[model samples]
Target: MPDAKQMVECPVAAMLELIGGKWKPVILYFLGSGTRRFGEIAVRIPTISRKVLTQQLKELEHDKLIMRKQYKEIPPRVEYSLTDLGESLSPVLAEMSIWGKKNVLEKR
Candidate 1:
């Protein structure tokens, strides 16, 4: 009920802006189990190139969906985990999993 100059966004579109992509949801689903190192994620999603994965992770981090932590040591260590915002997507991810299993996997 605002002025015509006010901009409105579709809820789904807004959500997609934060998490839409070929890999964001997959990344989120994997991280749902727990924290993961870069190599571990790379291994799980074998098809994604390291460059693309790194870009996706950066975008997710910028959106506040994931946290990237760097440990100080002779050999630098990094781990990625979900932020509270990211955890909120668990229900959505669960539903997607169920849908995929029933509609995608079962039919195949």
Candidate 2:
């Protein structure tokens, strides 16, 4: 057992510190299918502002959770996809989804 005075870095606590927000997980959820353009993600998560989406994407990329690829062309193209670290988070998200459905949503 950890001493009460000791600081412990629990996995959930560490993860939440990185991706805890209104949009990060949802952004990741959409990216789970594969790569997506900025506009594509914005379309699916319509409630989030463009500015917010950009911020979240930057943060995810910085944390090495998502990879951003840019294509050079007449019209520049960019797409976001999960890194190996991010893909590993899918199981955790799935469990959260199951619990939310059973305990939270079902209660309502």
Candidate 3:
């Protein structure tokens, strides 16, 4: 992450820089279940445009948080799943989700 070092020095801010976004957290949370295809993720998060989803997935893959596997098939097949590091974020995401529900959503 030499490139990251050039931009961020603080650990927490750097972590946010890597994964913080309107869609990244949700996308990562969904993938925690298991491998899913592009369509499946799109279906799960219907409000997200396909273009944005594609972009976010690429960024997550680039950051080594998720893995993308392409398969040879008639229409082309691809799948996404969490890397070990990605899975390691599950507890953190879970707490965020819980907090969002209890402290954030409930107040609304």
Candidate 4:
């Protein structure tokens, strides 16, 4: 974790420190759709390497943005879904999507 002094310097930076990355937002976007297994997510977001995906998922779990459920069976099964906190971010993402369509895509 970054020090308090760094967080105090820029709050938005601190927030991004948790979520900002090449793959984190993409992971969040998929999880927003519904619960998914790690393999499912990996296949959907093919650009993300397995190692980076694992790291991103771990970070999201640590931040309480996503919940991980593990099932015991002959082969272990695990699923991930957004927590309540993560669901709260959905509106923000939606709004960004809307804005992007209007400003970015429309411009193009």
lDDT by residue (5-42, candidate 1, tens digit) is: 44346666678878999999999999999999999999
Positional deviation of residue 20's Cα in model 4 after best superposition, in angstroms: 0.6
| lDDT (Cα atoms) of all candidates against the true structure | 0.94, 0.91, 0.94, 0.89
| Per-residue C-alpha lDDT of model 4 across residues 1-108, encoded as one tens digit per residue | 869887778877766777788888778878999999999999999988999999999999999999999998869999999999988878877776789889999999
Q: Which ten residues in a row have the lowest lDDT in candidate 2?
A: 2-11
- Please provide, for model 2 over 53-96, each residue's C-alpha lDDT reduced to its tens digit, 9 standing for 90 to 100: 99999999999999999998869999899999999988888888
Query: Model 4, residue 55: displacement in angstroms?
Result: 0.3
Q: Estimate candidate 1's alpha-carbon lDDT, on a 0 to 1 scale.
A: 0.94
Please provide the root mean square deviation of candidate 3 (C-alpha atoms, Å): 4.4
Find the candidate with the highest TM-score and give its number.
Answer: 3
Candidate 3 C-alpha lDDT tens digits along 20-91: 999999999999999999999999999999999999999999999999999999899999999999998888
Residue 82 deviation, candidate 1, in Å? 0.1
Q: How close is candidate 3 to the true structure, as a TM-score?
A: 0.90
**TM-scores for all predictions:** 0.89, 0.89, 0.90, 0.82
List candidate 3 stretches off by more than 4 Å: 1-8
The regions of model 1 sitting more than 4 angstroms off are: 1-8
Report lDDT (Cα) of residue 103, candidate 2: 98
